[model samples]
Target: MSRLITLVTAMIATITTPALSQTCPPPLNGAVRLVLVTAPDMESTGGLLQLFARETPAHAWTPASTPHPVRLGKHGLAWGIAFEAYKRGDEREKTEGDKCTPAGFFRIGPSFGFVASERHNYITIKPGETVCVEDPASPLYNTITQRVQLAPETKADNMADTSLFRNGLFVDYPSDRANKRGSCIFIHIWKTPDTPTSGCVALPEPQVKALQQFAEGGAVLAVIPQTARDRFPTCLPDMSAPHDP
Candidate 1:
């Protein structure tokens, strides 16, 4: 009996060990709220964006808002660093300065903007003080911190640009300084419908303001390109289908 038990234990471990190293997209984990962003193709500079919600963790996602237009990275989308997509062929992995929006699952905000948002833990950007670090060499790389925390020469995006970031939401994207797998991503106000971002998603002011509701609760952001859409079809809405009016 002891030997039989030992054999079964070893068999279970052997069966599950290799699964640990496999790089698949993260599970939805019954997220009640989601923000879906999908591009038509890998090179698309703009795509459809929408909000999905459910009554409970066990409920299916329903479109909370109409699919709206939004701007993507000038270089379009790439598989995120955490995503080692199998059989990817020539599809690029996100890297620093790629100008491509990192496409994969990400946690949404701790909502931010220029003014104090009454929603929840709103981050009020202070001009010349608050910044998002972009210098890969610095310890503060890919992190949000005050300008005073770094040496005068460090490269960071000043979050106080009211023209662009008057209303913004921080995207909790995983940072990889050693590999330089992109950094400083966010969802914010756009300069125009035609303009693209360095790597963040952008929308007009009104569209972005609608996202603040998730600041109190939590939300997941799914940025997937059309090439990989079927990979996780069960959790995503069909962008190709005509949405209800």
Candidate 2:
């Protein structure tokens, strides 16, 4: 009987080991700078955003900026189009019109603002020219294009919306139009402290500008819900730390 029990125990462990080890790891990809966002769960419309930086992969992530309150998608978060979570078919994937912000690591880059930068690929949102195509059926979906160049029927964000996007960083979410994973995700200004966004992360005007200055072209952003935060890398900062500005 003792021998039989031992055999059964060993079999159980073998069967469950793979499941236990399959926890999705943070896909930082050697990022030296990071913007980490976390919410309570899939239905939360707000969360905390913090920044961390390191010299290299071997260096520890030190706090770059203190935690700040940010408004999230009205419907909460879903697994992003990138990384293991969506590929494994284990979580709800972010899709077009889901009203949920995508959770994953993404690159931050070339800014968009009222003024253009001759030194960088910074987009200058011209009132009549700029538009971000959100229509999945359009061949130019997910791209920023000129209104005069696109079909007159194309549906897109004006991009010149000074109210919400006077200045912001484009979150390089790997959403494909064919997949209709999602589109137009960004870290722009919020309308109010308590207002929720339509699938993008929204911050205060100052923070949005500061983030653009800090991003420096290749910063990675990780958006994880509280339940899954522990599985990611250990760069998460302690919220209790006294560093708010």
Candidate 3:
């Protein structure tokens, strides 16, 4: 009986050991499960600079506030920067020193597209201006306005936008919050290879394809901060920073 018991124990250990060893590894290449970032960044640029994880899309995006995590656009990448909170007409007043990007999540695409500037092709928003949701009458009224747009030839090259955004993807802004403050936020290819976006996330075609692979149904762009990640289970830590873990 003792010998039989020993044999059974050994078999059980062997089976269990392999199962435990096969746990999923950390996100590949420190890839972010979601986008989180500051308020100002979110408003100025459609891309979120931070990251997070959640079962549902986030309604609010804040640098210091982590919301839920959702996949990004097939050709979309998020922007990075912490700015201060300020109303429209305050663009000059708000600076990198303030570290604000608003604090809310907005629905994303439903029509995204790429623009042909005659000279080159660029990713364009859903036409019209993107404004703060709270602020009506903005060019992007009833949609995302006052936001910035990065053309394929300007800069903010990530390689993904040029290849993937050849056709462009629809954008769905999160529900609620200020919009119409600006418009035309996008991630497109650029002339300068090393140029950063006015405030949009930029990527190459391969990255966009990778994004589509992960996003099953669809995806959302959540912008928050590293500190916010600690507050919410859905929120992910900021990994875009230099030498992040």
Candidate 4:
């Protein structure tokens, strides 16, 4: 009887280990809310983004909402200064105008939209007047501010009239002051299912709105490549290679 019990216990452990390993990792910083974005592969610009909720840190993550289809950068995935940089060497690091979406964990920044929502923390954009500063030399670099607030000589990308910026969630990238890490990363409305973005993650307007409604304080976003999903947050990229310029 003792031998049977031991064998059964070992069998249960063996069966459950792989299953547990396949579950999505916990939200960063112990956040109860998470947005999980998973692509088919590192080079694919299309994927699924899902919102997850956990009652407590000890509980497993459960889907808070349906999976939403999303479009990524035209050039696909690349390393960024945020979560990826810590895991992988900067060999394939993203740079300004690289057109590759930075893949890693991120804290969802302030929500913005042309229309206002009282439920979420939203920043309203003034068409033709709002701009997201991408110029590295400017004090407002990698930030969204009113054109009036910028220095007279500062050059910035006007985001006021763009549909992509009409409704969006900023992904905190280039968390440091270094200019080479890239800028203006966001999750925004896509033009179409076939359309890809400059670097932001794009979803339909309805989906974007849904995300805005579901996301709350202490939310985190984790972009996981399909190839790395199983081994993520554990098997990091090789760090020996020199960083890209």
Clashes of each: 0, 0, 82, 0
Per-model lDDT? 0.79, 0.77, 0.33, 0.72
Off by over 4 Å in 2: 1-27, 84-91, 233-245
On lDDT, who's better, 2 or 4? Answer: 2
Candidate 1 per-residue lDDT over residues 103-143, each given as its tens digit = 88888867887888677768889999999999988899988
lDDT of 4 by residue, 1-245 (tens): 99999999999987766532243343354667778777776677788777877776545677777676788889887766744533443335677788888877777888888876675557888876778887777778888889998887777878776878888888766444455678889889998898888988888888887777677475777776676655564322222111111
Q: How close is candidate 1 to the true structure, as a TM-score?
A: 0.84
Better of 2 and 4 by TM-score: 2
Candidate 1 Cα lDDT to native: 0.79
Q: Best TM-score goes to which candidate?
A: 1
Which scores higher on TM-score, 3 or 4? 4
Candidate 4, which segments miss by more than 4 Å at Cα? 1-27, 84-91, 177-179, 233-245
What TM-score would you give candidate 3 relative to the actual structure?
0.37
RMSD of each: 7.0, 8.7, 13.4, 7.3
The residue ranges of model 3 lying beyond 4 angstroms of the native Cα positions read: 1-104, 111-171, 174-180, 190-193, 212-216, 227-234, 237-245
Ranking by TM-score: 1, 2, 4, 3
lDDT, model 1, position 1: 100
